[model samples]
Target: MEYIQTVLFQVPASRLEQASETGGLLAELDGHRAYLKQQPGFRDLRLTRSINNEGNVLIVVETRWADDESLVRYETAEPNVAGIIRKHEDLLVRDSLQVLDMEALRTEASFARLESAEAARSRLVLPLIVPLGVLAFALLAIYGLSRIYLELDKGSAVGLATGVAIGILLIAVYVANNPRMPAWQVGGIFVVVIAALAGGTIWALVQEDEGEATGEPTASASPGASPAGSPAAGGGELALTLGDNFFELAGQKSPTLSVAAGKEATVSLTNTGIAPHNMHVADAGGQYPEAFCNPGGATPCSDPNLIKAGGTATIKINLGAGTYDFRCDFHPLEMTGTLEVQ
Candidate 1:
């Protein structure tokens, strides 16, 4: 079903090096790759060189064709391998050239097996890997952007992000439209993007560290005391504030709040950071029942809705004396606290 033609020759190691420098033997073979691609039924071409036992360099040029007729037609054409060898005879070892024509023995069953393997890989591996890769890239982009936004003022952060985004989009558009863009250009684009992301992230971290050294409080710092004029702990009212990946109450991280048992306590939640947050308190025995909570739910008491950045929500709780675990449903692990009703 397929055909192969191979031409082999040997040249002295020194001659090969000279040919390389003068674009003689190797360059001619490379030129053939493009030329043969224009011929009918040409499938592939490969050129390889190795050192022979006689200390000469053995060069092999192998070409695959769709059928025997195609190989025969190519051999009869002008400027074929035989002609090229004759042109470069002075550089090659005397009486060290051979040409062979062979039939490919690949069976139909082997082709079927290969196709099946490829199909399986497409069905199983690609779907999982592609999504995971996309998710990882998205998370990295988000982290870089968030860091930059945190370290810079709003105008500077917005301008930087917009400029970078526009540049990337333009490059993507150019590459997509050009289809045959040079490899070096693609590599340079990737290098620029990677460097920008890394540089922004590092710059943001350094700025944050300097701010900390200057005793500037971070977003995650405790709220310390209740806001002035806010309801007191004995007044059946409490307030909790949410920061980046953290929950604060009465000047503590994941702190415990006491409420009078069997009395309705109005707890207000405020999101002070740039991420959505909500509080969910588990029922007595610290159990979240399925009927009352959705999958991955923490319920029995929860904000009616998530509080967006700089937004607020109020929830009323009237539970018997018990300590209940509470957390942000969206960020359960990083943001958590306890409510003690006694």
Candidate 2:
């Protein structure tokens, strides 16, 4: 939810030397707007003036904030805001300044315009209920898929399941924001994700069949073996697999790697996942506190090389006999593994 603030002040005509002063005030206000715009979470700032029959001019300033925390930070520490207040203190009529803080509950135009209270209530309630319902259903789907798929590790399975849940929750929020959106369209988001998952599974199976027919080795089937279609592993070549927020070695997700002491190991990474990823190697024991390439005790971690969706990177490093950990900088918990130096 976003936060909004409105400030209104009345300036007497006597305070102005001429009509040109209004323009000068506005110009100064523009400088203030520019300063606020550079601040984080500053969405919009608007300044307008209204004249009453008594010839007193009312200046209204409306501001939109990304969240209350951003608003609070600005209010507490922003010298620019304070400057504006101080600059205007003499220009405004005595006791004319008013500030109001508010939270945006519902943003739909129809919700704001509805003549009936019950109708607006229904609109507000449905969005909250729909997302919760969709989340529950997504959890059930995840449970069913976990039961049917035997090879998925608990962590990987839960990650995938919760992803669907998050998608459903997002869809719910979208539909709620669009009160008039068609029901069928709202339902299609879930169907599309489910269909995509099924299609991906079938495609993976087909790829496995093709590999078998062509006599190429598969990663999952050959733990500790070199990656398929990779460079020769004569001296220091090893393979790392990247999937949707997960890492794999030889073909197994989060599998450990063994390297000889006082030697160099080149790691070739292939990303089959649908997102960009990168890997960083770090010493596990904190004694080294650096990235290891081969069998070295302490070494600087190789710079992270970006692997776009369906991309690969090969990096070589040297480490002494010690324990190390390699993980995706983007997803440490779901994509991490150990390296054993013998």
Candidate 3:
């Protein structure tokens, strides 16, 4: 095996000029090189200097040999390789002389061969693998977010999609950088963070809705002044009000409209707020059941009437004895109520 010897010494700045004038250091280095070159199996020698932050200069000598036998012969006392070293002892820092021996574990040829093989695999496999990975991540994010979109509003849906995308990216980065991490732990982190983002977003939206509904009256409370649990006159007109975040009936916030079965009723939606809104009435949970209505109207809804402040849209519905849900489709996230058919 090839052997290497490294020698390190610190030379004081005070002696640099004196040593240079006398050519003492250079002559000593030349003598050592000549001796080592003539030795059997000697390969090469290198000398270098480095300056540290403290302005101190470090001298280094590296000698290479073809085999361990040559290195051993130079270190042993029989050859007396200490003559030049003794001459330089006074110029070196106390205890600064250090000698190290190293055996080569790998050669330049071995490194070159390994690097070539790696490069070949990377060129062939990386193009296919990278695109496939990106496609897989995209599909996973879409599938995961879609499962929760129905329960969220438009803003919440977008937020959820963004959160899921970020989470997926983080998982990819984590897995790529930390291959030793347990698979279950990686999945657990992703699930926990994603769920937290979804739940927190939903809760914040609900709180905002409630706060807006309670903070001020955006519409005329008189239109929504109808009492809760009061049965509407059978087939009669029921007054309603649409505001920024409320579906008001008879001047009350979210008043439940009770109407008799097998009758027709008209819900007059008066927009008394800055934002425009329309009323959409469907079965209890927004299931548009096959409830027959007036011609040209599939669901019980008004055209998205851009009712200006104080404008109104009258929606007539054929009421049946069943529970139904009513909401302003334009602001469905916060404007909604229940319709009870007795």
Candidate 4:
């Protein structure tokens, strides 16, 4: 009747293997400490044995909520006190909770050193480190070349190329030292190299797109303009994308989520599988009824529809006081989970 509370005791990735054994560190430490005894709004919590785990076996528990927004915070906030939020969310097994507490009075940096250090180290290693090493060798070679060859002018073509190479190496070192440097931007270097090969393709695409948008013939299209895909959403919105055979959680998926006794919230479905996939929702009870579907199902039923690869779908349903099932009809055992509505 009150706040929905969830407790999860997770292990740092490094100690994962050690935490899986019985009475391991995960059970004794992370799991046990979730409770600051006598803490307000404390409810039932549990510690369980890890199963089918290739990683640490964490202790997980949950409770119910009266306010939808509170549920959101309860799900996200406090758990972040340590790194538990980031560590557990991906590997955690779904443990739904229904709160029975009431009168809940709720109130409301940066150790990015790893990132900076990585940038520092990567600079030292990848660009700076590598180029400096190369430059040292190149400088030695230049000296040797000067000693052995006839024309040893520093302004020669070889000398110019050597200077350019050294300059690029120095810039790489600078980038390695700068955390703001985007290593990926170096990919543009290849774009320049391929410019000749891809010039026509790029130009044709631009002209064709412009022609389509302006309803004109491609042969006589204007100089430069093209209809391009809209830029992606930046903040608080998730854009599911496919790479190879999987999906990436691009941005915030559920920006505004709602839950109530009779109100339904939509589930955003994406197929990240190699094969075509679909999504379906059912009650925690064995109702076997499906809800929300893609280009497949019409309504709630026993079998959910199949969504194709790189596809997406949606579902909305009202839930009352009980636990509900949320799962991919195909990857049932692995992709299945519960949606608790107290």
Candidate 5:
């Protein structure tokens, strides 16, 4: 294996610049190179200087040898690197020097092949990862914002969404203007914003679920009062409110509707939520045979069309005394109720 020796030292920036123009340091190193070339194991020599124009300039001198035995033979010689650098004590920074000896781990050709393979892999992966990461973040942002907005009134939702957008734009502008900002600070800002959005979305959903579970009405009920129980013995007309993913009857979620047997009953549906909804009652056998029920169908009863937010629709129920199932077509699993025909 090859043996390498490295000498590291620092000089005052001003002194290095002056020495370069006057060939002071360069001439001394050239004389030293001539001495090293006459040694038995000398293979190659390199000199490097830091590009940063800071207070001190760092310099590195590296020498390669054929093997450890040859390097050991040269180390015992008289005109060594330490003796050469000692002559320039006035130019170098105080105590800023180090010497290291190392054995080569890999040949130059193998190292080059490894570097080329790593670069190719990076090029292939970065292209796919960047676009996919951007797309996923965009989708998550949209979903989180939608969940938060769904809980607010129209005016509040618009105002909050606009403010959030403006805040994001301002942050983008700040990051663009301060390109030298620390990476950790930028990452912390992103993490805080995303966490805030996720927290708000979760809170909004929890509040909605709590409200639905408590059977709170989103809209005003009819003026006439019926005690909090099943509809009147012979249900003439009953009013129901459709909220987000739920149905409310007289401030009761998924309530049962009772009507006298062989009598006609009318149910008024008022949609107070953002999503469209329609009521569909199953047939006598408690089965919804049709994929899309028609209002004029012979079996189960259903609304002719979906009701938009703040819209209203009516369905007539007339059947033999029995129990039937009813649900909203748009949110069948979440918004369901029982119809009791006594």
Candidate 6:
């Protein structure tokens, strides 16, 4: 089903001197540019501006939906970006009064910017051979020691010593590899990751054998279904579904489109495309359609929760024929097309 995400991004209006544009302010706008969705659930979203306008600083969006169930799922489902929204919410002049609806596309850069493990590696442009080699070596040391300890079947002391050894080895490897970084900080993260992975493996080995003898497997109770969330059997609160992009309309930016002025329309945002994409609409009340003022997570377009990745959303509207900008937040510069509200 198609769903609509009617987002209202509210920015603040302050004096130019005190409210000068800075990293913090720009970051808030940037967050809006790429904030598609997160893991937990939808939290509050607020953007601040020191020098923006008053009433028009709001962004009104109408995300299309495929059906009622899809829309319901998105509103109640979890979102992963709550912390990011909170972290940057205070930096800008948060009017929470005005709304700014800006459309963001699931640009290649947008997904790349997410800093996923693969993305981080690609952006760094380093000789990965060395790092990979070091990682392999570290794994060997930890595993070898861990195996030895297990065979001996010693008490926690051996486990503790192995942990400490892994910690020191990780530090040595990091320092020898990237001395430029702070010795202490890098060492700490390196040791934690190595210890966790290695330690977890050892524990799992023991547990699996034990489970086999008991004749009761616990993998069925894995956290795969809900992601520690509620049941996915119900419709989506904020979910990613098929047919989100380029499905019915090949070469189209999004599968779902919004007809303006409150038309009872359904926009199914199926994410056929590999990258994530979100829709935004700005109401042009007989103007050039340049002003966008709105706040995120203030009220519901239909229900309040947001649409999820690869998920469909809906937007209902009845707009008179005029000009409106329906676009995505990812491709802010060129990923925009004209919407004539008939």
- Per TM-score, the best of the predicted structures is 5
Off by over 4 Å in 1: 1-235, 290-300
Predicted candidate 2 versus true structure: per-residue lDDT over 27-70, tens digit per residue: 66676787788889999887788787768788877888888998
Question: What ranking of all candidate models by lDDT puts the best one first?
Answer: 5, 1, 3, 2, 4, 6
Worst 10 residues of 4 by lDDT: 226-235
Please write out the lDDT profile of model 5 over residues 1-342, one tens digit for every residue: 679888888888778765565457756776678888988878988888884455688888888898898887877776777667767888888998888999988978669889999999999999999899778778778887877776664457789989998998999899999999999988898788878878987987785676454433423444243343456566666777778988787678998878677877777777778676778888888788765566777554446456655556778888898899888876889989998888
For residue 67, what is the lDDT in candidate 1? Answer: 85
| Each model's Cα RMSD | 20.1, 28.0, 15.6, 42.3, 13.8, 46.2
TM-scores, all models, native as reference: 0.33, 0.31, 0.32, 0.23, 0.38, 0.27
Off by over 4 Å in 4: 1-258, 289-304
Clashing pairs in 2: 293-317, 293-318, 294-317, 294-318, 294-319, 295-319, 295-320, 296-319, 296-320, 297-320
Q: Could you give candidate 6's per-residue lDDT for residues 118-169 as a string of tens digits?
A: 7677767566766886889677667755553433322353676777689779
Select the stronger candidate by lDDT from 3 and 5.
5
- What lDDT does candidate 1 reach at residue 12? 95
User: Which 10-residue window of candidate 1 scores lowest in summed lDDT?
Assistant: 214-223
TM-score of 6: 0.27
Ranking by TM-score: 5, 1, 3, 2, 6, 4
Which is superior by lDDT, 2 or 3? 3
Candidate 5 ranges with C-alpha deviation above 4 Å = 1-103, 106-118, 179-182, 216-238, 243-342
lDDT of 1 by residue, 159-217 (tens): 98799789878987998899999989977876787778878889877866565444223
True lDDT of residue 298, candidate 3:
62
